[model samples]
Target chain A: NAGVTQTPKFRILKIGQSMTLQCAQDMNHNYMYWYRQDPGMGLKLIYYSVGAGITDKGEVPNGYNVSRSTTEDFPLRLELAAPSQTSVYFCASSYSGQFSYNEQFFGPGTRLTVL
Target chain B: AQTVTQSQPEMSVQEAETVTLSCTYDTSENNYYLFWYKQPPSRQMILVIRQEAYKQQNATENRFSVNFQKAAKSFSLKISDSQLGDTAMYFCAFMTRHTPLVFGKGTRLSVIA
Candidate 1:
């Protein structure tokens, strides 16, 4: 399996511009997540989906949106980008079941720079 | 709320030596999971090891192991017979049922030959 894959490995956006970071998983995982990592900081969750059509906010969801219309794709949208949004974004997925300890598979991550 | 903390920002060790990276977390949930992820210069998040809070015995994966202290809320990773390939930024993470994983500021580890 390709596991999890993210598109646009590197991107630069002007202030007020918009773009979408695409994430896809071939493992058919029921849980998918979006996270952003700043320099010298831990990753903070932006949004997540338990399943298709069920999306929720996370710790730092401002200036971003997500849609999980299918099990394999969970795309993140950046609307009106700001410099504060400059960071490395990661996509991860995990198999959902009665247990909670399943390991999450992560993508290589996309580096975004907003000017 | 759940939070993971890695106290060490950077550490180095000679090849074939042993090194331990400390981690502590805050959570009220009794049952959860802890993980150590390694990110190299390539920027890929690799799962190194994992531990279940309810398991009394520690988890080991080849040269890597974890010391899980449920009562102390501490989960530290120990690397035995370290190699230069082990150089990476290590992250400690925590997760409860039905919640997003919480990550700590990564500890940069350099294995010198």
Candidate 2:
């Protein structure tokens, strides 16, 4: 299994610009998530989906949006990007949601810089 | 809200030696899961080991073992006979049924030969 994969290993966006971070997993997981990690800080959740076409806001979802069109893909959209959004983004997936002992599989992460 | 803390910002150990990374968490739920993830320069998050809350026996995977204290709310990773390949940033994470995983700031561990 290829596990989880992310596109655009690195990117730089201008202030007020918009972009999407692509994430895909072949593990056939039902739960998918997007998280951002700032320098020297732990990762904060951005958004997640329980299954296809079911997305919800996470702890730090103010500047971001997500869509889960299929079980294999969950993309994060940043609208009007700000300097505060400069961070490494990670995508993860699990076989099931809470109450199960499934471990999350994380992608290599996309490094984004906002100028 | 659940929180995980890794007090040690950095640590180093000689090759073939043993090192322990400390972690503590706060949560009201009794049944949950704890995980240790390693991120190397490659930036991929790798699962090192995991522990289930209700299980009394500690979890071990090859050279990695965890000392889980349910009462103290402490979970520590012990790397025995460490190798240079083990150098990475290790994060302690917590998750309950139906909730996303919460991660600690992480501890950078360097294995020197």
Candidate 3:
């Protein structure tokens, strides 16, 4: 299984541009998340979905949107890319059930640079 | 809201030695989960270990273990017999049931040869 995979490992966009970062997981996890890691900082949650057709905002959700139409794919859309929006984006998934703890599995990450 | 703190911004230890990284969290909730994730130069976030707030017994995985103090709200990671591969930016995170993780700034650990 590929676990969690993110597309366009690297990308550069000009200010005011728009793009989508694709994320897919083969683990069949019920929970998917998007996090952005800034330089010398920890990953900040951008968006999360408990299951298909259900989504919620996390700590940093501005300028980004996410939709979970299926169990394996979660794509993050940046409507207007800005320098402040540039960072390393990570996609993570975890199984949710009767258990209290959900261990998150992360992707390799997509490095985006908006000039 | 919960907050995690990693006081040590940077730390180093010689190969084969043991080093402990500290993490403290603030949450009124009595039940939750804590995690320590290692991010190497490659930038992949790898889960090092996890601890349940209700479990008094610490969790261990090979050379990586956690000392979870529920009362103090402190969760420290101890890496024994450190290897060069242990070098990475370690992050401490917290979460309630079914909630997203709240992460600390991170502590950069270097394993010297």
Model 2 lDDT, residue B97, Cα: 82
Task: List per-prediction Cα lDDT, in the order shown.
Answer: 0.93, 0.93, 0.93
TM-score of each: 0.98, 0.97, 0.97
lDDT of 2 by residue, B62-84 (tens): 99999999999999999999999
Q: What tens-digit string does per-residue lDDT give for candidate 1 at A1-115? A: 8999999999999999999999999998999999999999888999988899999999999999999999999999998999999999999998976337888899999999999
Superposed on all Cα atoms, the candidates' RMSDs to the truth, in angstroms, are 1.0, 1.0, 1.1
> In model 3, where do residues sit more than 4 Å from their true spots?
none
DockQ head-to-head 2 vs 3, winner: 2
Lowest summed lDDT over 10 consecutive residues: which window, candidate 1 chain B? B93-102
Q: Tell me the interface RMSD of model 3, in angstroms.
A: 2.1
lDDT value for candidate 3?
0.93
| Candidate 2 deviant stretches above 4 angstroms | A97-99
Cα miss at A90, model 2 (Å)? 0.5
How does chain B of model 3 score on TM-score? 0.97
Candidates 1 onward: DockQ, in order: 0.72, 0.72, 0.65
**How many residue pairs clash in model 2?**
3
